[model samples]
Target: MKNLAESVNIEAAEIMKIFQWKGTTDQLTDEEKTHLKYEIADTLIYLFYMCDQLKIDPVDVMKAKLEYNKGRHWKKDKE
Candidate 1:
């Protein structure tokens, strides 16, 4: 497997190709989906790096956000 930086570069190129070939955003081909998978993976890799730099745990942050959202949607007994 390639390193995160390498993946990011690959993803960037694929993104450009996506825009160039599939001008219309309404639909995408199988090739586009493949490109998108790489893009998402690249984004996640970058996000993890950022989290590391900031001294934050991505897993914890995600868990906190999920818990917060769950509480927000919870109904009160009085309702």
Candidate 2:
């Protein structure tokens, strides 16, 4: 479980490289775009694996969370 969570975060960080966070770089190259695709897939794969390993129903959890969020009052702060 811990490994999967770590993998998900690592892959997300890898994907973030394409976006030039904190003025680090320019746009993604063709190769970096390809890497972005793979990283996103990796994140999802780890997430699915973790859910299966925990015997958790992702669909149900997602729905429940969505419903719960729908009932909550919220606002996005101005940037």
Off by over 4 Å in 1: 1-27, 73-79
lDDT winner: 2
**Candidate 1 local accuracy as lDDT?**
0.73
Tens digits of lDDT, candidate 2, 24-74: 556667887888889899888898899999999889999999999987777
TM-score of each: 0.56, 0.70
lDDT of all predictions: 0.73, 0.83
Lowest lDDT sum, 10 consecutive residues, model 1, at 1-10
On TM-score, the candidate that comes out on top is 2
Question: What tens digits encode model 1's per-residue C-alpha lDDT throughout 12-72?
Answer: 7766776675546468778778878878777787767767767889999999999888757
Q: List the residue pairs that clash in candidate 1.
A: none
